[model samples]
Target: MTFSAVSPDEIAQPKPELRIGFLLMNHFTLMQVAGLVESLRFAADESFSSRQIFCQWEWMTCDNQPVTASCGLPVSPTAPLDFNQHWDYLVLAGGLLEETRNPPAWLLDAVREIHARNIPIITLCSGAFIVGNAGLLDGKRCAIHFTTRDEFRQRFPKAIPVIDKTYIKDGGIISCPGGTAIDLAADLIRKHCGEMRAEKGLQYLLVDNGKSRSTKKATGEAATLLYDNPAVRKVIDFMRHHLDSPLPLSEVAEFSALTVRQLNQLFIKNTGYTAAVYWRRMRLEHARKLMSDTDSSIHAIATTCGFSDASHLVDWFRKQYGETPGSFRKRRRDVEKLVKP
Candidate 1:
């Protein structure tokens, strides 16, 4: 995700970098459409002039019919779905909740065909609905927009619906909920196109690249990258998402397909801390963040972070930060007051 400004000679040379096939569903989201494709265009050419030099994206459809957007705008397909046609990633601009159930045969077939070729599928907004109904997301971690989390869970019980992550990838499926599409678009550019091209594209879009890093960490993506073991990563992510009520190590271990002892050993190897210790620190860190960012009382913050009471939180907080929660919150308030006009 690092993209420092390179010297003139170090800039990426023009070449065929990324090829993406965009599948526009009925009643698709137009905002996601503009942000994703426009970012890719900025990365594709010099000075915001799009010539598809470094990246190529096409609007496609299954039956060559015009796909109406949620805003009442009808967009004709650029081409029909051709399984033989190669693409780096097949992206879906998703639609409403009702569209998910009993999807049309043509749409389902297109997804199966595209996946059979081993091309990755990127789902934006509710498009995870399409992929999940198409049977492409079984046992995969799919990022769901907060509004659709419950429905996605009921429909696809095997698929893990992650509301915290901005974007996520599981094997061939990549997903982003809502406007997080911008960050996902940036990630795609940086992965296929060179770093220079990604930076230039964001520069034109005026996107702060630093926000992506913080968002990723806030979404538990930092822990996912710490260990290669999929089970360890899953357990850590579960821990982060449940900071309000930390689950037992045994239950989480079972969720990750590892026993309690096995999970602890992997955690020690990957993160240099046992599961109990790491999870405690994660809860304490969350409490600290709440103290600094919000105006909640100590008892409220303690409850949110899974502590029995304010005193329970303070004991652990002092052990970790060398000060009580009250002191930290006071210092942050004082510093902010001093800086404000």
Candidate 2:
């Protein structure tokens, strides 16, 4: 179909003075940091006239020391992390949350100080752990990596955790699951700047490349019975649709037109887990999402995820994660504090 195009004059320009700082720690993910920098650089280049994108930027490392990425590559920062200068936005980009003991008091103070002033902050990947540590996410809605979602939930039951979304902007605090760094930056550019500049920034980054984009199904409902196997897929689809209230193994087997033993064998063969185990895992996944993304009570979460009670959920979670759900959520919340919000 043909469509009308808007003239160049109608496109909005980005304001150039927005300062974006990358808070680098040891063993940071290089790709995520690079993605953020490149997106901003592209935005800056495209909006040079307005100077609204990249005029003010800095890579602030802990103690101004040279940092190493998880991949063993070294990254030298452009500036020392002195919380003095006024920054418009800050990003906590690192993967060393598990080892960040005795964080410099200044860094914590700076985050708290800056966030108290209402500045925006973004955390990528495990950096959410640092942000959570900062205590800024105590009652805010945020996103964490799916791999780390369970840990995050057990740690911070108060912080609302979202599922599946790459990132979330709850007021001034922006949290991304990481890896999808470009999406986070693009959202920032579009929100604080403009959609056109964000588009151009994407183009500058050559982000419309293969494997970087996902093929989205037409609608949520379109995925109701997506697979071709009428019986097995039907049971799978039902489980997917009822993640908040998962069916028992017997019910699943009946729905799939198989006996319990037959269904169990087939599921184990296909997914490397028994039917009950797979269903529990699926329910736990939904529970993890709710735990990380919502303020729901543990009791409610347990029931929603098809557990008999909170204790049952906790027992399974601990067996799987080596920690209680509450502790895990708190740990992630503690990490989120590292980002300046």
Candidate 3:
């Protein structure tokens, strides 16, 4: 079961094709699975055809049984688990009530065997909990949905939990919070296939904005709340790009091509927040991400997030999160240290 580290030359010339195996948990999220599979499907061919020239995938289970999604959609497995076959990656598509459900004993043993063989493992959504339960996530930083952060911390104290990130790669494991599987798929495509193919796949999916992982989730959630209005969508996109130098209310209104009064009415009618209030919230979200993801100084983060100064950022952060930025970062760092061997 010994495996050599991948050389730089090998990475520079990745294999022309990849085999992917997906293990679906009961009541999995359909969107998460579809997002990842569709990205791979589109990247498998040149433009419109569904040929498997570069990537291949198979839905799998322990006993080749059909699995139902959280939305009550059923999908039949295409194959049973085959350990001897060469698989570039194996992903677990996790379910809704993951805290209550344990993966079957056979499946847990299969994952451990796969890990021993040097095959990379990916955990989407609460599937991370399964791997943590298997002792695979010990001494590794993993991604979990913010809603599950507290439960994950309580359950797997040996695994470092990272919030606000779409996906993280620690050693041979790739972990992501639920609902951002497309980003993870695109990253894999870029790494193995090429930049052109990955960009084309994203463009085909109409996600060309190139947002960071944390910001992408926020924007997606905001779009859902705004009811997909074209004007509001454009305004939000503009605001995201200008976080370090936010526009004034008048300019934002002008940019959206709506009168100031109309903009205010639209914001309140749709999101129950005025344009100014929404803008401030977006800034705060960005600041929180910076504080968690980077080691920038408080002053640097405040300036980057358009706060007046470090004190202003601290004041707003305390009001929103009930803690100063330094305290929050220190707490997270302490938790991370606990995961180290």
Candidate 4:
């Protein structure tokens, strides 16, 4: 049998070597730390990385002693910190952020030192606070647990917290709301490698049915965004995936195995709105995206978003944004031009 030689470019790009330094301390969430580690493991699986797995890591603590997580899991560092070599990524993992009064001086010093050396820093969940203490997030986009998002903003006025996102990556400071650490890990894999490996990792972890990093809420704050409840999340996911042909409440209720009354109650309790109201808001958001991103006519956008007509969409648009869709698009485009120029 004859075979052709595969060129260097044709082969999968050599996976980038990764040295993830975990700055562990008391009360770090076990799942958060494990999720990140396991995702990398899955990336190394041939099913994911296409036989090019290149990542190595170790745990490090500030004191070089055994660290116990908030969930009572114990871990020991593989080595002590050495500042000679630059790290690929430095991740700080911990919990009880609101209660952590004073971070050790060494942590601050290490963060500042590594940061000055131009290493990318990442914070998990409440770990963002420590990153904030080091002043790395100043004037950078980041993510924090939604529960502390307001306070994070108040404390670090220069750091932008994306309340609606699962993570934020700006200026080499990657921050993810850690309450959903598994999602955060998946996101990190997607960043360090690519979606193919991330997807395979998710599959290996049995999280393939979960939403993509973009679609998942930052944390349990799904209640504030959509509605707090598993049923609501599922229903909203269904509707979003079928925006052009939304299922009726009856069908949604059936899918969720809940009666109409129960579903309505849950939606109301979580979002202060009924199922009908939530669906309308979802459609409106969809309409907004279509209007801003495409030159489709008002009628076309309205029909696509399940509105009765353009007039119906215009009424809702004006009610929500204080302007007509056309005006909103024009204003948004002007703003985009100004920012780019």
Number of the top candidate by lDDT?
1
* Each prediction's whole-model lDDT (CA): 0.73, 0.64, 0.72, 0.67
Candidate 1 residue-wise lDDT at 341: 40
Give residue 255's lDDT in candidate 2 (0 to 100): 78
Query: What are the runs in model 4 whose C-alpha is more than 4 Å off?
Result: 1-16, 47-53, 98-100, 191-195, 213-341
Stretch of 10 with least lDDT, candidate 3: 1-10
Tens digits of per-residue lDDT, candidate 2, 1-341, equal 11122234532332233567788788877777777766666665344342322334677787787778887887777777777666778888757666443356677677777677656677777766666667777766677777777878877777777766666655356777766477666655554444555677676666773423331121112222122234545666778777666556787777788899998776644334576876787787667657666789989999888888999999998875467889756744543342213
Per-candidate TM-scores read 0.60, 0.53, 0.57, 0.53
Better-scoring candidate (lDDT), 1 or 4: 1
**Which residue ranges in model 3 land beyond 4 Å of their true spot?**
1-16, 98-100, 210-341
Local error of candidate 1 at residue 262 (angstroms)? 14
lDDT, candidate 3, residue 42?
82
lDDT for predicted candidate 4 compared with the true structure: 0.67
Predictions: Cα RMSD each = 16.0, 17.5, 17.1, 15.7
lDDT per residue, candidate 4, 201-305, as tens digits?
A: 777778745465444444323233323345667877777776766567898789889998998887765444677777888788778767756799999998998
TM-score of 2: 0.53
lDDT at 93 for candidate 1? 79
Candidate 1 per-residue C-alpha lDDT over 144-191 given as tens digits, one digit per residue, 9 for 90 to 100: 888888888998998878887767776467788887376677767865
